[model samples]
Target: MHTLRLSDEHLIGLARWATDRMARVERPVLAERVLGVAGHRIQDPRARADVLTAAAEARLGLGHLPRHLTQAYAAELQCADEHHKAGHRKAAAASAAKALILAFHRVAHIDGLTSPLATDPAQFTGPLRRSRVLRALRAPRGRVTASAAPPADRPMRLLLVHSANDNFLPVVLDHYRNHPGVEVRVLDTAADPATAPLAKGLGRMIASGIGIRSAYAGQVEEALRPHLDWADVVFVDWCTAAAAFLTLVDPGTTRVVVRLHSFEVFSYWPHLVDFSRVDDLVFVSEHLRDLAVAALPRLREPDAPATHVLDNAVDLARSPLPKKPDARFTLGLVGLSQVAKDPRWALEVLRVLRRQDKRYRLRLIGDSMEPGVSPALDRYRTAFAAELAPLVASGAVHMTGHTDDIAAELTNVGVILSTSVRESWHLGLVEGAASGAVPVVRDWPFFADRPHGAHSLFPRDWVVSTPAEAAARILAVNESEESWLESGHEASEKAISTWGWGTVAPRFDSLLCARFAEIPAQRRVRTIAE
Candidate 1:
């Protein structure tokens, strides 16, 4: 199952069938459903090239597709990547769609092909043997190297690595950026010229995952060597290509910690990571840790690193300002964009409340849906948009868009809603709660009955299973101005006391500075974010 290869004769036969099928069609379209005689048509130039490249590989009995196909895939991925970096999210999504379509075309019409996703985590086999090369490259544990920890009093050097978004790094960065005892540098592989190839080199990543070393491996080794050398501790933000890239090289003596926030548990990257090289593997929640462990059987091996659950840093010092009497009517949802946020659920709650009281308006804070990320996302966005159109026109909802000053916006919101279907942490609701907004967290369906979810993260009274329950809670709490203020104040006090940085920051400080031996293992991952 690990070797999902199609033989040359098998591939050639499929291609011939597709070719003949295309010849028979009166009108050829680009859609996935528009099959040629065999079952699909290459609609775009990139996909067309893929057909030729795949045919060339089959004809020559080559082990891989031609260079042109790989380059085309990498270039398209980079194009989408640039859009994401520039905050042209919709445009970025559009570009990524093209890349996905081309990738699909690469395997079109073949048996066990047509679907546009990767194999399930359990399907892919990991390292079969630590070949001679692996033995030579691996850095043995507990050995002293040039980057070993410095004396306790010396400035501790830290390098933060990010493969994509860095939204969660602000707390860590702000704390150490100018610390007299620490030197910190951030490297975003998405932007770094040398490391950027590590991200965009689709062919390289594939070849390396299957135990083959290509030029891209040398490029990554060269690019990351200096940064790894300069740091006493390397904290890679996500379990992604950056983490995989780091593990490919033997870190002389630096402590490497990789944090798996949430979605990466379902991605292919975690399987590619060589756990023996990592000293610490962190997760924001326990459920995600469980799923990740289940997906990759290797984590159970003795070589797996020590695991820790670290809460995301939230600056809880910002005290809540007094709210006006009318603030009771405003419900706020802080972040949106991905389909997972499910703003439509929040709108449903708004509808339930406004049936009796029209003043119950919703303030939607964050970016509108970006349809370019995937076809599924685009469909969800379209459906959600249709549902929201009438409400926006009727003034029942206000799309405030994204903002730099979230604290200022929370002032008018008495109720903060977490309507997400899934989340590793719900930072928006907690931030709003720190500002004295009553939190109404949905029982996140992804882990509702499973261990460690919104239900376990917050007080039972703060969580609801449906829009009706959320509406009822809102109605009961906001019956009078006194009742609303009293509820909001209580929620605010609990959020800061339990989850605020005042309580959480010290844990992080201890984590970063403590000797690896001091931190306990298999601890529950906790976050007040959701």
Candidate 2:
């Protein structure tokens, strides 16, 4: 079907018409629906964005489109900055939040928005722009009454919040969800693809820190208020935007707890979070806790919540069977969806081990490294594939792709390798150990200079500083079937006693169930205009 071609001026006029209609409407719900219809008719990227300009006019508008379409929208944002300069702090904050959200959307990964935390060379880097944006966002002024603190015998209402990565929380979720003493609710932000990525932007957060209370506070309150009010104690599973969104408002009397897994310390989210609002901050490892505290000095502040290092929950009961007699020569590494897993390091170690005995084979039991996370990650995957291709063709490397049942996957493996440069805790290594596979953990380089890292986390004998050392350790354990079996048994026991959920759940209970409590009104987290 041939469509009539429209001039640029005509398209711009259509966008203007939509924005005019948006201004006339009261509720944004209707305007948003109407704008989307107009946007759908525009095949050109520029025209699509022109149509989106109408949506940005709403108080909590998020103009998160591809960067090309943001030009006309930028003019609207300038009005926000103009308002801010003219002392309309709240309007400026809202405008900045909408603009930043659109400008920094994760989908705009080509040039400027690739690294959300990195300072852009083209943009001004004054501190208050970030501080001003955050300050303008504000919080709920009236403390909504949360469910009362349950007695020792009653269940504590626990809400679990995570953005997209909930891999570490499964066992913990199952435990509390089934526990008679704790009631549970989980909110996976990624469950809704439309709004999920929007949470990743820091513009609203920067506005929040800017200190001028904003209309954004009311937006956050409206989205999260019900969950906040329902829970007695909210346990946010990751130190992500979901966690920050929960703390954006005062928890009223409900206690707030946040778990910091490995990667978040490298992001700006931790720095943006107001730690004084939290009741407890949990970590998967002490090394991560130390890194977070050092990364965000605010955690050391007097009102910073109590911190605890709870191991990532693992179910060891699934892997109790003995390995095959020849399992001694088998090496396994699981979960390689990120470049950081450094599968090439494991390959290097395999090459060294295979030189001594042709029987040695590496079993990679998860998805391959994801390509195109960025140009750097894509390059890493390309190089890794070149290295891996010949090895797989030679039968020295076995690619299992992905698996739902890791217990069955590790059964043939005798040695587990942790080649990551950084980790709060290596769950795959621990699980391998539980399955009677001896672990050879690399001294994770990110924290090698720190007081504690992989060396402190695992047994000295199990930790290695180099691929040659890893090869030597594997050889030492697998010299004989008897020696390998005995070593595997010892690793299995240690894995179960220490990191397994049977033992670790009690530690979580002490932190989430025991110490969690209602905050006094005087010390409650600040709302917009205290």
For 111-182, candidate 2 gives per-residue lDDT tens digits of 111222222312311222333333343222323443245566667888888887887788888999888888
> Which one is best on lDDT?
2
lDDT of 2: 0.68
Task: Write model 1 residue lDDT over 1-530, tens digit each, in one string.
Answer: 11125444444355555434334443323311221211123334334434543432341222222223333434454555555556655444455444434433322211111111222223322221122222222223222333244468778888889987898999889888867778899999888998776765433443454345457667777988899888888899899778877777667668788999876654446645766667778888776676667555557766567787777788877748766666789999988887678888999999999998999999999898764654445656777899899999998888999998888888878999999877787889888888888889999876786767888878989999999999999999988888888888899999898878768777776666566546666222111121
Cα-based RMSD of the predictions, in order?
10.9, 11.7
Q: Each candidate's TM vs. the true structure?
A: 0.73, 0.73
Q: What is the C-alpha lDDT of each candidate?
A: 0.66, 0.68
Candidate 1: worst 10 consecutive residues by lDDT? 108-117
In angstroms, give how far residue 264 of model 1 lies from its true place.
1.6
